[model samples]
Target: MPDLKDLNSIYLIVAFVVPGLIATFVRAQFINGRIDKMTDTVLGYLVITLIYYGFSIPVISWILTFEQGLLKTALWWGLTIVGPACFGLLLGVAAQHGWLRWMAKKLGLRVVHGTPSSWDWQFANCYAARFVMVTLTDGSSIAGIFGTASFASTDPTERDIYIQEVLDVDANGIWNYRSEPSGILILAKEIRAVEFMKEL
Candidate 1:
């Protein structure tokens, strides 16, 4: 092992560690997971880096065979930086769409989903706007529009919601726009259930 103060050791760290961090960060942007802990994140980066390197060994070997030249430098750059970035993007997309999971299922392997919870999945996939009726634990229901402006908490533990354009639900179940409140923020603890209805 090289000394920490040595220039070669520093270069080795930069060549390997930076790419892994970049890939992990890129993957996190597309996938939802409980990665709040520092230790867990660091460990994940290291693990991902190792796995990436393992898979990229063939390419690394091929690059090493080239004599020192501009092409060799470019290939080295691809191995160190561009390669990992592209790998992260493709990996994240594959995981996000369950392509990897689907394939793993064929092999009878146990695998977990990328999303933290169903709440994130629902809000993420529900692109079209609709009338949302939120029932509270206190037995009260608030009706509003779950449009582009509305928000759902992505935090796995926090199942909060924000409904834009409050509505009045009459006895006949007709929804009318409220004149007072613009939107309502419902906390996770208070929420009992949520119903989405198509606009009439």
Candidate 2:
């Protein structure tokens, strides 16, 4: 026969552990920018916790009335195992629906995709007074100039330029390259603007 104290302790442990496990699983499945995903993940976890508590109270109360011995313990174990799994699955599904992508756009970040061209390299060496390497896919932008061709690679259809420094360009089309992280070399022909960053 489980005592009242034992039942209470078991319930408390289940209540805490279930939500935590759910939150952990949610975090693991979704990979994106940290700040954006974290906010949504926390909000989801809170809602799941509330729902679990609300439903469990009535169910546990009813179970306690019928089976007075180890019934509460069994219920606690069930909730601990099941509650988090369900919540984690829900969060994982929500994450796949462009949640992080939308958040990145909201924050004035966008992704672009393109291959490099030979003309781009020529432009970099000659006409490209400076260079700004913008990673449209990752929403990361680096600025530098055509210091030198650190490395180069290409396929039958495209070329890539690895710039020693990233260049910065203004709306006026002025090139201003500065010393920054080493970036990839891409051909100019392959360069294509995919997305834009709107003011958030």
The per-prediction CA RMSD against the true structure, in angstroms, equals 3.6, 15.8
* Per-candidate TM-score against the hidden true structure: 0.73, 0.33
lDDT of 2 by residue, 1-200 (tens): 22437988666544654475564565434422122244455555556677666766876676667655586767666666666666556555455444555777899987441113433323323422343454444454544544444433324344454556555668896656455554555553555431222211
Quality of model 1 by C-alpha lDDT: 0.80
lDDT of each: 0.80, 0.50
Off by over 4 Å in 1: 1-9, 65-75, 156-159, 177-181, 197-200
Candidate 1 lDDT tens digits, 74-111: 99877878878887898888866778988999999978
Candidate 1 versus the native: TM-score? 0.73
**Top lDDT hit:** 1
